[model samples]
Target: MEYLLFRLYGPMASWGDPAVGSDRPTALRPSRSALLGLVAAALGIRREEQSLHDKLAASVTFAVKQYSAGVLLRDFHTAQVPSQDKKTIRRTRKDELQTGRLNTVLSIRDYRCEGLWVIAIELTEDAGWDIRQLKEALLKPKFTLYLGRKSCPLAAPLSPKIVTSDCLRSALDTEFEPILKDSDADRVWLPKSDRVTYYWQGRKEATNLTGVSSDKVWDDPVHRQRWQFSSRTEHSASKHREE
Candidate 1:
């Protein structure tokens, strides 16, 4: 099987998880919806293009090799908004501010600092776009790409490459240039573990790694406009590395 491979390295990344109230949490790895959104942005697909988004979603699956989950960082934000009134119509921020009566809203956001992950994208049977086309789009994305949020801009190049492998694990094991220099790693506290983790979706046979566990995550995109997502089973495995 052929896969499109790339590296995502940034100072901060926010892989969104299920949100509750004003507190937003992040997952350890990038969600499927976030990966698809990255591809759609690279291909210049807009949010309003529902048909196109649906086709793309059905056309590909994802795998991830997590190098560093990064350190957890939390932020607090407070913003002022106009008081809610059903009778009043505020077209923009300017109009809302003009109301004079304002309310303060508080939100807590979470992030992963200095996170790194290698992503593997596999084309499905109904794939409309080939690996080469996707590679080129990623090389020169039509729209700017960010890790997960607009504030978390990428600190390194994606370094996309196409490789053929017998299984998903082999594709993910393909190496690229290191994100950080030896000196940088020594000076800064880069997140690392004795065991490396792998996550993938699709049939077990597709990913040859064994002794895996499964869990349901609600990251599957159903509709971008409506912000709807469906749950899907994800498989994971971990291996210990020699110190």
Candidate 2:
């Protein structure tokens, strides 16, 4: 099986909640839909294409790395209102104003410069898709696609190979070297290790400092560690479906 991992990062990123309306928006952690949309746009798929939706059901995950967290608001410029000509006013009474025209203005709110998040998309194809094809499609000069927000662009290259569980663990350890280790031969796990799921937000305790023993400090939940793991079960299923 093959996969595509993206290292998403930028000055600002806004991944909205699925329940938000067009006017009112709320930012949430990355979701499956947002990631799929990014992949679709990278592949240059049109909105009318059904294949993209069908192909997205395979196992996919989003690993968000929060370097900084903040919010931003923007104003809306364009809005329309009812005209007085040939328009019936909904309410006309002694207590109500007789004006037939009403003006309405709208504003847009969004998140501004925030931290970076790495989104790794795992794509499994049995027919054997080339990693270079995925890379070329992503790094194209005119490509304007993004995982969640326009400002948030991919960080690392798209690796089109299934990353093993051990490899994923090792990668995280390597990325966060001193934090995950106390000494050359002794590595200690945090107290909140069981909650070490994807997108775990936890505070870095004092023990998390360099040269400190893991037992010397308390474990505070601040931000969760985000990682992706794929196993043989998924590999076999993806192969059967493709065939």
Write down the TM-score of every candidate.
0.93, 0.49
Best by lDDT: 1
Q: What is the C-alpha lDDT of each candidate?
A: 0.90, 0.40
lDDT, candidate 2, 1-243, per-residue tens: 233444444445566543334463544345444555666577676555555444543434333333333445554665445545554544544312345455555656455443333344444544233555655666662346664666566543433233433333223222322223346325432221112222311222311222211112111111112222222111000011111
Give the CA lDDT, 0 to 100, for residue 13 in model 1.
95
TM-score quality measure for candidate 1: 0.93
Which candidate leads the pack in TM-score?
1
Query: How many angstroms is residue 138 displaced in model 2 relative to the true structure, after the best TM-score fit?
Result: 2.1
For candidate 2, the clash count comes to 13
* Residue-by-residue lDDT tens digits, candidate 1, 95-133: 988889999999999999988899999999989998899
lDDT, residue 77, model 1 = 97
